[model samples]
Target: MRKTLCDTLGIEHPIVGFTPSEHVAAAISRAGGLGVLGCVRFNDPDELDGVLDWMDANTDGKPYGVDVVMPAKVPTEGAAVDLEQLIPPEHREFVRRTLDELGVPELPEGEQKQDGVLGWLHSVARSHVDVALRHPVRLIANALGSPPVDVIERAHGHGLLVAALAGKAEHAVRHVDKGVDIVVAQGHEAGGHTGEIATMVLVPEIVDAVGDRVPVLAAGGIGSGRQVAAALALGASGAWMGSYWLTTTEYQQIPGNAATQQALLAAGSSDTVRTRIYTGKPARLLKTRWTDAWSAPGAPEPLPMPLQNVLVSEAHQRITRSADPTVVSMPVGQVVGRMNKVRPVADVMADLLAELDETIVKLSDLR
Candidate 1:
């Protein structure tokens, strides 16, 4: 699977693994793939600094990246207090009621819940960029859109690549125009925030549109080596996989949320739904009671990004702490059907390469 992307990123495989866990990221890079660490969950710059420090020490001098959510626009303005006030009481009450109905219990008196929507702000995202650049990060990716031009230029100044995720071909062009080094064409089948397009159609469209300008990485519903091969066949230089890494042992080691992993293992492709109930964007999430509640009649409309995210942050923390399977909201792709068991990151990477080689041989034999 060695391609131009591999050369560009100085990796052996054209696979780019996206995960929130630093262990998983380092493992992917050590296994000859580029690991992109998700930074949206880090509310404190020091927290991110610690993770990057661990990654830098553990990646065996391999290339890895950082992913941040830098939306082109936001609803709240001025200060953090202003942003919290943007969330209406009704929305907050709805979230609380949904959790109550799902039997998700509140956290213990001494323990505190994590801040969910803090990192989505521009200031926090900028702090992430600042922290990542201080380290030897090879790439910095923005999940929402093309990061500010200043971010792009700053990354370039440090000899780092800037990547952006686009759901449409035009979005890819815009990213390229903004000096993005890589464009990840994530389909509607992807986890977290996504747009309405399938990978098969979106990949080639993005490839044809920006094939000559920049490298394209295909995402969404891609969990296996066959899917990676298909992405390369469609002219993508690599496969940017997120859902596939969720079940890795390295990921499980972080926080060790076995309930979430168990839910993913028990899921089929159809067990997911695209709804804005989670992050106020059209994101694919596990069809649990929380997601189903939002679709019920008389359910209030979800507020826009940041507002809706803030509305449900505490509820999510409660559900997570409770470890309730029915109420857990894990962002996953349609490819969850294949994630049936937990495995080590090294073993998963080796199996993927082996499968790719076998698939290639079979194809060559057919001719």
Candidate 2:
């Protein structure tokens, strides 16, 4: 797995783990793979700055990256109050009715409801970039698609490599054309916002389209060393894995996520469903009663991007607080099936490398 990506990113392996947990990200970097922290979860730049400060102190000086959500076409941007006002009454009623039907409880008396992710807005995402640039980040990845030209240029000016997630061959080409240094061909099986292309088909098509121009990382349904080897065989410089890290012990340490972890541990490969109910885009999420309710008759069409998220944000909180594993809303790939047991990030990374080596030897023997 010692591809040019390893040398470029200054890691021992070509595996790049995408995680939202700072501890998980640091652990991955310390274990020799580049860990890219998801930045959209941080609505406050100062908070993100403090977290990055912690990351800098930790990770043993190993390289790490940051992923930001910058939609190509900007969405409705405003204050939380203004955005709340934009949500239709019908949508609000739907959320309320659904929560009631699910028996989700209200927050504790003093607990204030958390707002939806503001990072979906371009302005907020740009602030993320501004904060990230001030850190020692080696790479900046856009979760939605190619970032703005000036943003890409600014990252380049800071001597950071820019990567964009692409779900199609054309999208990959466009990323390269827009001066993106890396293209992550994330398939439909991927979590969060995704397109209809499967990894097995999308990886090779993207590699053929832009592998010669820039390194392509294969994402979606990749959790083990065998999948990493397959990604390399398909011309990817590395495997970009997100879902596989969710069950790591580091992530398990996060507060109020035990129910979510239990749901992931109980899932199988066939248990996932791709639905627009998550983020108002086709995203693979764990099949649960929450997702099921969205498909029932008379379920209104999900609002686009930020608005839909805003509408359902508190509902998600209520469900999580309800501590019902069967009703928790989480964006996870089909790989969640394999995420059965919790292990240290170091152990997982070791297993991945060991499995990759064993797989490589087996493939070599076929000759």
Candidate 3:
């Protein structure tokens, strides 16, 4: 727990919990660890403000962070073609039918929902950044890649630390070049959008590539203290985690979104198909019937971001409303196999720190 992460973050434990729930955020920060709030699901700025404000009041000013999904590769930013123009009407129809087939009913009457018109593209991402910067957050983490240069500059200007995820050394190098404070070397075993590199290989590679330039935190397939030990042994300052926190007592699990169902659907979603159903990026997901149907040889090709996200957003909404975890997929990594039990947030933190200490002591004995 005395690593650079703990020292830099001024926490007694380096256990960073990633969850969208503000309750978990406050709990983790209260327990002396970084509680990173995920913002991809929230398209509203006011909702984010309320959540962060509540967390700030509850955590007694203990440091916490928020993560946003701003992919480095937007469909048509650097290219000539427009992403929206590229989407086909048949693809849209297919998505509508997919939702209909799933039986996700329309929202009840008078359910006022605020949705951004441009979707999660660059402009909306920047707006979310503005909303986040207004709150009392210690870190600004970009989940997909290097945050926009302007965003990073703005965070640094406000004295906030900026971090980004990397699947390779060159990606880490780009982040460092862009003045990213931390590089999370994500591997294939990670849930959501990930690269092909494995954690064991990518961590050291990033460390060497970064040198003394910036700190590197290992990600992907890191669910326990042993995995954190492996990351530190490979020269990372700490471990950035995601999948491990999904099954905690604080998470909003649907009826069957348990360990058994995760394993049962593991062969389908966990088999590692990088599809664009979620965010229009090469994200890893459980190879479910939906993803398989979209990825099948004769099936329609996935649409680009924003548009693709819009296509499946209705489907996800219906699935979650129905609480059917079998056909409705949750983004998770291979670490799902290990998250068989649910414990309190503080209890989970204690177990991780204790296990890390034991692992470190045993390794010292070995040396």
Candidate 4:
């Protein structure tokens, strides 16, 4: 309650709910926490505008943030990609053959009309950032790495806070030097694209590395109030959470689609692996038939972001909509193991805050 983050963000609770679903975003903010809408899933700025407009209408004046996938390190812009270029014929053939053998047919166009290309690269994400800032988004967070200098400058120009995730101490320094308002020490256990350091080790290292230049939000494998308290103890201002929200009632996921996501966390750590089957980036996902097929010794390696991502987007989208347990594999982290049940988003936030209060009280009562 007393942390600078809560004060700075003007929220009743320090809990930050990260979800891409606009309804989930509004629900979390209405529940007294900040809701962050993940924008990497959007194909273009227009799609982002639609979501932001809906969020603006639903959030009842509560503040929320937007997340973009601006990787700090990327191949030269436009050097390789002509977004207009379709997937390679060979790769496209492979997907079609696999689907045919599996009897998965393309849905009738009567399904939702898809927006433009996916936004997982620096160039496309900048456009997303522009759309997000033009709206009332209170914060801008970069999911991949340090926020770009121009991104940070633009966020500050619009009077918004900017945060970036780092998987190492060195990345934390890069974020600080670029004027990031918050540094999320994201461990390898986080969902989606993550670097290779464990959160327990990375959080303290990054906090120390930054040396109070910016606040740190400890992430990766953090789900419970005890974990949040630990992050604060590790010198972070708070915890930045993702996986914990994936199984909530408001998830865009179909009801039964959560099993695999849940199992990734419940099973051994080996249950998960960094593969690009879903997004083409080295995102940490549960080892599913989908991922295993892509990573098998003989299979072609997953492509880079956006390219690899679009390859599987149709399947991921259709399955999530179908809510068919047999055909779906949701993206999640090792923390999904802790996401044991489907609960209300508000209830989840309340439990976290109550647990945090209990943690603080218990610590004070000691001795």
Clashes of each: 0, 0, 3, 2
**lDDT per residue (tens digit) for residues 235-322 in model 4:** 8887788878776777744344464444533554456778767666677876655555666566666666666656666666654555
Reference-based TM-score of each model: 0.97, 0.98, 0.88, 0.88
How far off is residue 120 in model 2, in Å?
1.0
Question: Ten-residue segment with the worst summed lDDT in candidate 3?
Answer: 75-84
| Best-performing candidate as measured by lDDT | 2
Q: Pick the candidate with the highest TM-score.
A: 2
State the lDDT of candidate 2 residue by residue for 163-194, as single tens digits. Answer: 99999899889889999999999998888778
Candidate 4 residue spans exceeding 4 A from truth: 75-86, 100-103, 109-117, 252-270
Q: Once model 1 is optimally superposed onto the true structure by TM-score, how far is the C-alpha of residue 95 displaced, in angstroms? A: 1.6
Candidate 2 clashes between residue pairs 3 or more apart in a chain or in different chains: none
The global Cα lDDT (0 to 1) of model 3 is 0.74
Off by over 4 Å in 1: 78-80
Root mean square deviation (Cα) for candidate 4: 3.2
Q: If ranked by lDDT, best first, what sequence of candidates would result?
A: 2, 1, 4, 3
